[model samples]
Structure formats: structure tokens, C-alpha cells
Target: MSFYFNIATDKTVTADQILEALGRPEVSVDDNKMIFHIPGKSLRGACVYHSDEGYEVGVNAFTPKTDARLTRDVAAAIAWLTGASVVPEDSEDSFSPEYIADYGGEDWVAERFDEAYFLARRPDDAAEGGPLSVAGYKRTFAVTPDMFEQDAGSLEDAIRAVMQVGIDLQTLDDREDIFAASLMSFTPPAAPPQSTLRRMFGLSKPVSNVREPYTAFFIGPDVRTLTPYNETSDPFYVHLSVDQKAVFRLPADDFFAYAEAAGARAYGAQVYDITISQADHAKLMQQAEPA
Candidate 1:
């Protein structure tokens, strides 16, 4: 399957210009496809030179990681050459030479760009082991009135701190079998009067009722650890009864909508969706945490 991005341009350019912009000279065309591979990368792809009406480029899937980079490179090349921007034919996302520098990894597609890019194609299939067998990834935390005495660059950064907590929890759970899903979403703000009696009694935990942003991203097939029924059990308990998956698993695309409604209502705080890759995570951590 070939993933395509459309480049809309008004500049009068020739096929030679497009090919040159591709920074490649080794190319051949047949009735099937124009084979051209980016230097030093296992990119299997073709290009459709732009007409006055704009043109498209596509790549046969090599790997999600490879394909994503190729998609961005070709699109960026075409956009740079034509002095225009590129948008995925499958999504509304538009990227110019400037934004082209944005990380276009597979994870970034779901985290920062349009999730539709991945959803349009079986993105998980691009991997060898395939995506984890999880229903999704989730993170829920109370957005304290302050970043607990830390300087949160933005509310979003504060949320990232919480998202990191969830990632750490699952990574230690099943090791490599899980914790591969990207991060997404956060809750709206919430506030409840601090209890006078609890403080007077020296109880010192922030109220859980505070605006607790909770969100789960169903990026994979399994979200929870399922316990199978076992016939052999201790005499104190039934052998057949075992714990089942309990993680919040929802494949619906309305995570943000749900966050909005829940925040506007009661109990649940507003949830804002955020999507990020492991590289993004490292970048976040490399920066000093909110002081």
C-alpha cells in the first residue's frame, strides 16, 4: 500500500526541477511506478510531478518508521521546491518547509499530527510484532491549583508530568509486551473548597476531587491485563474466579469530546488530548522539570 501526500503549488516548475529537488538522479519509470529510493534509506516510493492543479507522491510501506520519514522528506522536498506546503491526502494536516522539520515519526502522526493518517492505514501492521495487544494507553491526574510548588511552563507541561507517571507504571508492569502506545489527552480543570476539618485534623493530601484530568488512548488492541480463569485455586478461594482486565479501554475517537463534557459536568475534570512519541518523552525529560 502506498501512502500519499498532496503538494499544491502555483509555481511553474518542470519534472526535472522536481526530481532535482528530490536530490536523487537514479530513477526509472515504467507502466507500474517510478522507482526512486532516498539515499541511505530503505525507502520504496514513487513521485507524481505536480501540474498547475497540484500533484501527489506516495511510498509503498517499508516500515512505519521508514515510511514516515520518507513521507516527510518527499513532501518537504516538493513543498520546498514549489514554495508551497504539503498536506496528507488522507488528512487535513498541512506542513511547510518550516513545519516540515517537525518530527514525522509514526508516533508523531498520532500524537502531534492527525491520528487519521495512521487510522487510514493499518499503521500497526507496519511493525513486525505488530502493535501491543492493549486496548489503549491511559493517564489520569489531578491538575493542582499549582504545579505542587513547581513552575509549570504551561498547563500542558504540567500534564506531561502526569502522563510520564502512567508510562512508568505500565513499562514496569509487563516489560516489553506493553507500554508502547503513544500519550494522548488531558482533563479540564476542577476545583473544590479545601476541607477545613481535614486540615484541622492534619490530613495533608490534596483533594482528589480537584480538576483531575483523566484520559485513555486506545492506540492498540489491548488496554488491560486479562487474567484467565483457572480451575486450580487455593482452598480459601474459588479456582475459576480470577481478576479480569480493568483498565479504561475505549476505541472511540471522542476522547477530547468526552473530556470536554466530563469537565463541564461533575466528578470528572476536563481532559485535553495530547499525543507524543518516546523521542518526545526524552526531549521533555532532558529539559529540566518544572521547578
Candidate 2:
């Protein structure tokens, strides 16, 4: 199923203004309505129309295929343009396994189901000195079995519930343990048999033998900050750093290529590209563990 969100604001905005906010050119504009399209991304089309209550900005279709962060970015942009709070539409209930399978791949959705089941079955209170009770208080959390049923709505609700709990348990200063747990559970897809070219290029090495993939969290910069770098004439690559030491330079095209090749997926509120096998992921997790 597709997703949708609405922005209700009292500020006056025009079609051109909306397009400008999205950094897209207006495709068509009537007296009361304007349409814009994003060429290649999940955000396909959007329309801004005048309304009595306020201006309404609606997206064409948003689904698992769409970048999850795009919704929030769009809402923020609309709010900025109209000077009003953008009320996002909640279509989480409408998300189904069938839709996710159709758009995001069956294996991807199945893994989520497995994770939900695992989390649901875990005990609310851990054993003494266990991870959950380290802070000296018993933690209570459980997911109902109904969430794991072979239905779309239940699965969606269960996923959302689990994600919400995970988010709530996270602290700003600490590492995201919930996200690490999810990463540890991932099983990489079986790679194709090495071909002559792959053998020549030594493409069969374990991911650990290659450059270790690191998670770079980008905050403080809005979407607009990337606009100049994204321009076709002067596109720039991403340079990553840790503790002021330059780690690597990621070519713009290679970023998506690695993700697609490795079946890398993003998790949590912040975008994270998990580009390593379960073993490698576990290794990273161990490194990040408190001494």
C-alpha cells in the first residue's frame, strides 16, 4: 500500500514557493493547484493546493520503497515555506507485508517478521546483571503474538510498536543498542558464484578483509545543504572522518552501488547503511561495547 502525509498550515504559499522549497521545478500550475515531480527518487510527485483550513501539501505515493527520512524532510520544507506546522499523515497501519515484499523484497520483509517475533518472545525482565537491568531497574517490554500473524496490518503494527520501544529506550549520548541488535540479526544474501572477472579482481574476500564499512551519522545539515553538491555540473563526493582524521572518500555513485550489491539496508531514525555480513556487523558491535 502507498503512504501519504498532509501539511496543514495557515501561512500563504504558492505553487512556485512549494517547488522552490523542494528544489524541484514546477511541472504544471493552475490557479489553485500546482504539481511537481522528483525525477528518480521515491518521492515521485507532489501537489500543493489552496484550502479553506489552510494550504494542503500531498504526496503522490510513499511506501517502503521511499526513503523514510524523505517524509520528514518534505514536511519540514513545507513548514518553512508556509510558516506553519506540517502535520504528517500516518499510514503505518496501512503498511502490509505484501506491500513490503512487493516493493522492498520478500527476504527483507521476512527478516523484519523474524525480528519482530524474536523481540516479542523475549522476557520483559532480564536475569540479574543482564543488559536490560544494568541501570538497576527492571525493564518491561513485550510484543504480542498477534503482531506476528501472517497478515499485513498486524505485522505493520508489531514492527512499529517494536521500533517505537527501541527508539524510546535510546539515549542521545550512548550508542544505539536497539539498532545494533537489529544489525546483528541481519543475514546477508548469498552471493553469486565467483566468475572469472570476480576471481581476477579478488572479489571473493570476506568483507572483513576489505575496508571495514563504518556508520557515519549526518546531523545539523538540512537537505538544502546538499543541493549545491548534488548539482549535475559540480557534483561532489562524500568524505568521511572520525576524530578529525579522514577515513575515506566515498564516490557518490559507489555509495548506492555498494548498498545494492551487498543488500545493505538502513535502520533507525537516522540513515545507516549496513554494508557488512553478520559476522562483520557483530565485530563492529563488539568494538563499540563498553569496557
Candidate 3:
């Protein structure tokens, strides 16, 4: 099987242009993606290195029926292919044995077809037995395109054709059996305040009652800003102050929306207790009642 690499980059240049940029020959570009034929006789299986946002790097595979998810196996394979350091702590070594036991086995696949194919096609000799790590190969070099034909037969020529696009290379780690590319770039838009907090903790803010002020709280790290939800509203972000004081600038009047949506038990919602460090609490108190 022939190995190919498809890079979905953050640029609009064609494959030929990428080749030209990289000063390589024998590569074809179809729109944004560039496919390359890697060197090696036996076509090893493919892997995927994906980030939270941005492009996903898929290894060339003999068939598309492969899982090729961002997992440990994929990370290891990509590290081997790219000559990047596949840190032991980034692959299967990072997974706890007890955690694996909870899920039946470490390499267990839910799909029968996947299980069978992986077992048969896995590169047995290539498998790293000890703590997995990425090793460097000398032959690998960054390349650009040249005035080469669309169809190049030589593997070296083809690899040289695969230009490095603007896809930021993040830390390469293995998740389960696939390689995960933790892309360093590609930032998504920030969500709304209530939604953001809800998603983070999977909980809702407590309602503000006349008897008790709704404690809008945030603890830990530098507090960016507590801007009002609206332009007209006062800066009511008085949950905690920089001095770690628990302050309530505004009363809590809303509740049940998030709790209802989260499907939290009645008892669970009632007994909700969020703990913070003494230092943080003091900071809030200082902010709550300024001299």
C-alpha cells in the first residue's frame, strides 16, 4: 500500500503552488488539500492528527474504511512519519491502566470491522513496545515545489513536492489508539457569559432573592473583567473581588433555567456547594466592600 498525506492548510494556494513554495517536484494539488505519496515499501495504516479548531492532518491510507481517529496509535504513526518527537507521555503511556480496565481494555474498539482490520493490518514490527516516543529520521527534509509534472513516480520526488502549508503544528499527542494534533492556533469566538460558565461547570447560577444577594462568583487566576451583561446595566460582576472578598453587587433573581436544562436532581441542585481557596475568598471580600 502507498502512504499519502493530506494536509488541509490555512492558505488558498494550490498544491502546485505549495510545491513551488516548498521547492519540490512531483505533486498534484486539488484545491486546498495536498496529497503526497510517502516513501516505504509496505503501505502502513494511516492516522489523523486533529486540533480543537483548524485543519486536520490525515495520514495516507490504503483504504478509507480505517478509523484513523485522533488516538495514540495515530499519534505514534504520525510521529514516525514526520520525524517529530513522539513523547512517551503523549501516547499510550499517558493512559492509566486502571482507566483502561474501566473501559474493558486499552485497545478495545467498539466496532467489529475496526477491531478486525486493526488487528490484521497493524504494523506489528513497527509497534513501539516501551514507552512510545517520536524518533527522528535523517532523510526527511522540508521541501517546496519545482517545475515538475503533475504525476511523479518517485517517492522522494513526491515527498519533496509536499510543501509545508500554514497549518500551525501544535503538540502531537495520542488519544486512545489515534494520534491527536493539539493545534496551537485556530481560536474560536467566545461564547456568552452565562452559556460559557454553564458549559464549563455544567451547572447554572443560583437565583438572587431579596433575603440573599445572588453570589456571582469567579475564583482562580487573574480576573479579566466583570463587565455588565448589557451596556445600560451597572458593573454588577461583584461575586468576588481581587482581594478575595465574597461581594454581592447585584442580587440573584434567576435560577432553575440551567438546573432544569442540566437535568440535575432536586437534591443535587439544593446541596450545591462551590468551594474556593481562602486567598481567593479574601480577594472577593475586598472587592465586595471597597473602602
Instruction: Indicate which candidate wins on TM-score.
Output: 1
Return the TM-score for each candidate structure. 0.31, 0.26, 0.17
The sequence of per-residue lDDT tens digits that candidate 3 reaches over residues 1-291 is 222123222333333443454332432222322333222211122233334322233332222222222122333333333334333221333223223223222233233123323322335453333111111111111111221224647533332222111011101111122222111111223433566767689796653332321224333333321111111122223234444453233221122232244342221111111233556445444444331
Candidate 2 residues lying further than 4 Å off, grouped into runs, are 24-33, 40-44, 60-72, 91-291
lDDT per model, in order?
0.41, 0.37, 0.28
* Higher-ranked by lDDT: 2 or 3: 2
- Candidate ranking (lDDT, best to worst): 1, 2, 3
Candidate 2, lDDT over the whole model: 0.37
User: For residues 125-178, what per-residue lDDT tens digits would candidate 1 score against the true structure?
Assistant: 443332212111122222222221246465344434433332333223344343
- Model 2 per-residue lDDT tens digits across residues 1-291: 223345555677665665566563523233343434333232223445566776554433212222233333444556676556544354333222223223334543343235334444445453222222101011122233333345456655655554443333322113332222111111223445666787789876543323333223221111111101121223323333333242333444454454455554322221233434445333333333211
Q: Write the number of the candidate with greater TM-score, choosing between 1 and 2.
A: 1
Poorly placed runs, candidate 3 (over 4 Å): 1-11, 30-33, 38-53, 60-291
